[model samples]
Target: MRTGRPRQFDRDEAVRQAMHLFWENGYDATSLSQLKAAIGRGITAPSFYAAFGSKEKLYKETVACYLHSHGRVTDALWDDTLPPRQAIETTLLRSARMQCETGHPKGCMVALGVMSANSEEHRHLLAPLDTARARTREGFIRCVKRGVENGELHAGASPDTLGLVFNSFLFGISTLARDGVPLSIIETSVRQIMALWETFSVKNGNELPNG
Candidate 1:
């Protein structure tokens, strides 16, 4: 008698489930068993390996999915048509709202996922996350540079310093969300954060404080 074909599973759905698992629990904390369970539908170890290649590979795919889905809001940062201030504000607001949403994991996958790498191999596995973060920082730098060029910000303002500050604040919002801070509070804080940009405005005629 001919054997039945192996059961088929939805690869996209599996990646989303795995993304939620990784988003809820950091890379080192999530296990193969947990991953299989999260994928469900009786996905066996061999089947899992055949489908995803390996745990690290699966995590990479999951991160990509998370970026494409929940993380796409920040793409406004790269929109040259928007004013620099608007681009930064849009990124901050979108990120804050996304992080605080109740449906998904509380914090940003990029911010919380793979924070601590136990080994060189693990670091390599998490390299994409690092790249994601670097890209955000670079976007901030570009926006700040554009602000200077457009005279929205003072010529003496430092893009590197401003980028670091903005990226750090963005990352901190993820931590606050994970800590159970309310969405309303995060949104309010976003407004306050945007006010800092005003202090850098060329219209305000403010200069960086001397050391």
Candidate 2:
């Protein structure tokens, strides 16, 4: 006989497992039984129901898990060391890389979910998705403001306009990737987008580190 694995499942771990499941397959495709199996916690349906209330609640928890884990992009982009435009480029490239990388599921959960408008719950899900986008754009605005203060970005550039333009472009890229755009095309497109932003940055004026 051999020693067994850890006895109890951590709630966070379970939620992470659920996040992967939901990320791989949308809410409508993933069943409660399937979630039980995917989590590998030997969880009973009644237990899951009692704890999470319903699949909808479980999905909300999964979104929370996704946000908490991936929100680092916003944090990193807002770092003061990088020029605002370059920071936006870095975040977009990283996000594009994630969409093309193996092991993890491709595409954004929000964009993928928004593709269909079949149900009220599905439509409701777009709210948090939009909120995430808004939060990301806000981060960009803050970064641009910091860049302006330090003269790392163009002084005349409107932060609001730049934020909307960059955010809209990023959302479009995510939508394309979510819709199964080819990896090569995604890479090339993202690189071009980054290059465009790089041209407008104050890096050439000796404002940012290493450009």
Candidate 3:
């Protein structure tokens, strides 16, 4: 008897499943067999190829899914209505909480993406993640500049340097989260980190509280 079309599945759900595997294992580390198993037992090699074209294509799709979803926590850094300091604090707190939250992989895909493929041959595959990291770093610098422009920070504050302080801390959060550090501790540390910026803050042409 002639075979009928294979039963269909939820593409979004498949992608989400694949994304978690990639998040936890990294691209180079995760294999086609693992992806097929994670996506669903029914997804044979041919079906997998038909659905996603190739492993590289599927990996790129997962990256897009990640950026659109879990990666959005830092978007607070780009919000203009909140005071620059508040924006920075919100981004840090949000990202920390998210990286530590249940129901998803610990840590950030963007932060861990680089570790996915260390070999030069696969390095180009992670360009999107590299660009995302750069964008977040730029967001920090932009927020610092906004603070300085509005006198929220002292005139002597260096946006490049100050932003690096926050950016570096933000990047480190992923490692801490992955290492099973408690969210509460990270949050407490965030407060201290914010205080570091407060030391340079000003209000009404005078040194701000904690300055």
Candidate 4:
């Protein structure tokens, strides 16, 4: 008889599945068995341990996947050709559409986890979320600096402080979006923030950060 080769697991797909499950149910509510079932591997606990090493590791992979998908949206918003206010507005509008959907899970996994877990493993699992926040702040700071160099932004505002304010607004809106706020209200709230930027007027969308 001829010997056949064994099948291999798709690590990325496995993590994506894990991410959706965790996004829907959170860390504490999801058990190992649930993870195993959700991942759809015929493998046993020993195999899962061998593949992912630990639940914490699996959680990290899940968060990384979520952030990777989300970062693309950030990339489009952070474009140098767009005004700072438009960038921020675009992100919020997109988020409103995604978060308000009836079929998909609620809010961001990072925001939801920040609210739900306290175990050291859970905290460790969430380190990626901290990194995502820091990256978002850094992107805003970069946009502010670019605006300053181009003379589009006001001279008095500090980039560091601007970044903090921007991040705070985003965080609050993200939480509200998770809570199922209407898109009209979300758009109104975003416009209110844009009014403070001063360099860019949301009315005409003419202010370009680079041009």
- Using all chains and alpha carbons, the TM-scores for the candidates as numbered come to 0.91, 0.71, 0.93, 0.75
Backbone clashes for every candidate come to 0, 0, 0, 0
Q: What is the C-alpha RMSD of each candidate to the true structure, in Å?
A: 1.9, 6.3, 2.7, 5.3
What do the candidate models score in CA lDDT, each in turn? 0.85, 0.69, 0.90, 0.70
The sequence of per-residue lDDT tens digits that candidate 1 reaches over residues 75-117 is 9889999998899889988998999887778889888854745
Candidate 4 global lDDT: 0.70
**1 or 4, greater by TM-score:** 1
Candidate 4 lDDT over residue span 1-211, tens digit each: 8754343667777887788778878888878898887665655787678779988788878777777785355664568678765676677566656665665576666557675467775666667777776777787787767666666665555788776776677667657866778868877877777666764422344453442
TM-score winner among the candidates?
3
Name the better of 3 and 4 by lDDT: 3
Sliding window of 10 residues with minimal summed lDDT for model 1: 112-121
Looking at model 4, report the run of 10 residues with the lowest lDDT sum: 201-210
Question: Which pairs of residues collide in candidate 4?
Answer: none
The lDDT ranking, best first, is 3, 1, 4, 2
In angstroms, give how far residue 184 of model 4 lies from its true place: 3.4
Q: Please give the RMSD of candidate 3 to the true structure.
A: 2.7
